[model samples]
Target chain A: MTASTDPATKEPFERVVQAHGDVVWKVCRGLLPQHDAEDAWSETFLAAMRAWDRFDGDRVRGWLVTIAHRKALDVLRAGARVETREDGPPDRAVEPPGRDLDLWAALARLPAAQRAAVVHHHLAGLPHADVAALTGSTPAAVRKAASDGVRRLRALMTEEPR
Target chain B: MTESTPTEAAMPTVPATPPQRLEALHRRLEAAATGDDAPDVHYRHLDSAVGGLLVAATEQGVVRVAFAREGEDAVLQALADRVGPRVLRTPGRLDAAAAWLEAYLAGRRQPFPLALDTRLARGFRLSVLDRLREVPYGERVTYAQLAASADAPRAVRAVGTACATNPLPIVIPCHRVTRSDGSTGAYLGGAEVKVRLLELERTGRLPD
Candidate 1:
């Protein structure tokens, strides 16, 4: 039977995961605070594994990180407390330098779509072209959202100490 | 092929940006990408029983599963960089990953059933990977076979290239792709691992 049609012919996928687990975790940790990082880490690798067959292995690392980053954002959007889940979200610190907490808070306050564009480009470090692919949007639209998100962040971060 | 665009100018300089972290993350991920016993411990803790985590996504009804713990950081960063920082990990998203992995490792499962996240690849490479997934696990195929499956029968060399650059390995089962002479070809996870996987399907042994 052909590989595609034969069920028994599929190779084991765990081997690849055994190969790159740590790389997945660091991406989750970087985006998430200690609290919510683990779940994000797990979700990232899991997502990568499920999609392994269709993945072009040329840039495996890039591919995995992209999934993890998106998954982290999904967690944040759910507003699920980090502690409640296996991979919990990090708690907001009392205060962060440069109004970091305020920035995230403002980001959280913005529309989910806008927040995603800003975070992916500014914090995640993806190129615009790649960003376009991930978000299913045109490069022009991604650029606009990023600009708007940044403007919103700056406004929230630099607001008069009211 | 390796040029940076001018649009990068709009990006700001943040001291704590993910780039530095991604550099370190990439090294660990790449090292871990090699299918060796030792793995990067900086972030992921591997337990063979759990079978490591993976993410499977697809387009056009074909799925690719990428198995790597180290790439997790990179995946998250890619999402953040590509999509947005709003990326958060979903709860129990790994259930499917863990289930398929466990079953595959225990020999209880064959034919990886996964969803594909083909957000990155475009064009021909994507088509090739889709076809690669159809190549059965135990049965080996020549590069010529793969090229033909994709309706590009003459592109045997291109088929080899596509297999070499597959982002997802086992899920796509590129290891099943062998030389025309029936000899084992190179595998990203190593020839031994490839042999072992084949043996596992052929003899049901854990292949030495």
Candidate 2:
């Protein structure tokens, strides 16, 4: 067996997925509904594998988060179309309503930027600059979005249920 | 009301449990990535008379056969690092190789029908492996004789090195090469396995 000393090529793509799958899952869950989140997470890795040879970025987590962000957006856009359809069922059971319903409900209330910022920067432990790159904003904007998102989430998590 | 820091508030409260079907999902992703027009390398461990053996093969052919002494994880990690990162632990991809190995270890003397990727061997060392395959079962050849057959009679030491490093052992029959003084030489799977293989070949049964 050949000893591969080159760090750039040493890490197999499988290892990459195994190392970052949980973080990507959390990011997707924070952005999309749980059911759609799994799909987004799978798509993110598939896409990453396709472009793996060309990936020169040192921050693999950042690169993966960026791909997941785009995939999550695609799922949201598709969900929006189905929601707008007049003939759609009133209670589409795409995901079974479960105990995490309140958590998801609170997350859904946050603005898109705030949710992405909180998930990428706070949950995934990516630097603000990396989150900014993913969100297409400056680092300062991402930091502010994360803080505002957390403040709003605190208020929502503590409010008495109706 | 007690105020919480932004970091404390942003701490992910949702249970981060991995999906129940994570393994299945990984398999599906690997399959999709290898779909049509790519060299897919798949591997799996097989229980054999010797021990657990890790077999890896590409669409081209059986590429590597590793003994358990070296540790399957380390061997697989090396395969992943050296070969393409597209390696997956799917046994179905190695059905042909596994069947051939099972038959061979059971003393069936079946020739490996799969193509081989000898990319790991090159130049004179590769030629040495090619010559090693020609050594008939139950027979033995000294390292010098094998070197002579490879048209490099003076490079007997190099011949030994080639046998020691043969990526596809057993199938390539590197175990048939020995020392010139009528003794078994070094083997990649250790000298004991080499002797056992030779004895199995001669007796048409695994030695007790």
Candidate 3:
């Protein structure tokens, strides 16, 4: 309920980023690789700033998530040169097991529907119905996919480091 | 499928983004937002003889100048209310205004050599401020005389109000409008600054 998230004072786009940036980053990272996630993050915020005057509702997080979803899809649709296990760790040393790289690697293994549902509904904090609408799936199927995605993530993360 | 904390999802402990990467993105956002003219109000603080001056501007021109006596938070809220909510303490946007104020405080007393947006003042008040600026760098005028100059001779009290609410303060030369009794009547920055400003014009130095 503080000024940062409340929007009671008509929170500026800067506060919007300060409050929701980490979640948006996670959503992007879950859907794409490190490089592509960075691209999507930049695009989402810039687009948000451009249309900021017309944004009246209080669902700032959800609004940003929707934009991030579209931007991530744009990157994938452009060339489908998206994240895969074989993309390997970034040019540096292999990261520790519990880091974002590891979690994203496991997420990369899920089916597209499961990944989208899990990223949007879990990481980005969009409701199940909202994620369903964004991906054009029904709520029940989204729920199942997210549950299945979580179940798979738990197992994959606990496996021996590759 | 829980959405508890918007930024902090509790399920998988997402490691914090590296500080360097996060800082790079923040700089990128600031550049892009300014590139698109998104930060509607850019403000900076300047050290001046009178006090710490909060100078804020928009894409239009210099818009607000406040003394330390007026709380910085209140001044910023006023900007957000009157101007736009995209207020950011971005540096470099206000370097020109800072230079002008610094020069004036150093006893140069030149008219502000930049565009000024006086939209906060309206109607006769705006006229009073307009005439107030023309009173010249070294001269002083009575509020009554200023009211006559603005074509509202009987609205002398209104003239006082205009100077009191002047958004630009020292830059617009509201300190030049004095009481007919030859005393500095009132100033947004208080009377002592009014005296020092006049002395700066007369002796070319602010009193120690």
TM-score of chain B for predicted candidate 1? 0.61
- Candidate 2 per-residue lDDT, tens place, A67-112, comes to 9999998998887733212212321343334435545556667888
lDDT of 3 by residue, B1-208 (tens): 3545332223566567666766566666666666565677778788887789999888889999999899887887778767776776655678889988888888776735787888888888888888887887789899889988888889989999999999999899899888999888878888888898888888988886
Badly placed stretches (over 4 Å) of model 3 are A1-12, A85-110, A154-162, B1-10, B17-23, B34-54, B66-81, B84-90, B102-112, B180-208
Interface RMSD of each: 13.7, 5.1, 5.2
Error of 2 at A132 (Å): 1.9
lDDT of 2 by residue, B77-106 (tens): 677667766556666678889888888888
- Model 1 CA deviation exceeding 4 Å by range: A1-162, B1-46, B49-76, B79-91, B109-112
lDDT per residue, candidate 3, A1-162, as tens digits? 344432236654556777877888888888887777788887888888666655776788899999999999899888566455433656224344445566788888888998998898878777889889899999989988888887787777778275
Q: Which model, 2 or 3, shows the larger lDDT? A: 3
The TM-score-based order of candidates, best leading, equals 2, 3, 1
How many Å off is the CA of A7 in candidate 2?
9.8
* Per-model DockQ against the true two-chain complex: 0.04, 0.30, 0.30
TM-score of chain B of each: 0.61, 0.84, 0.85
Model 3 docking grade? acceptable
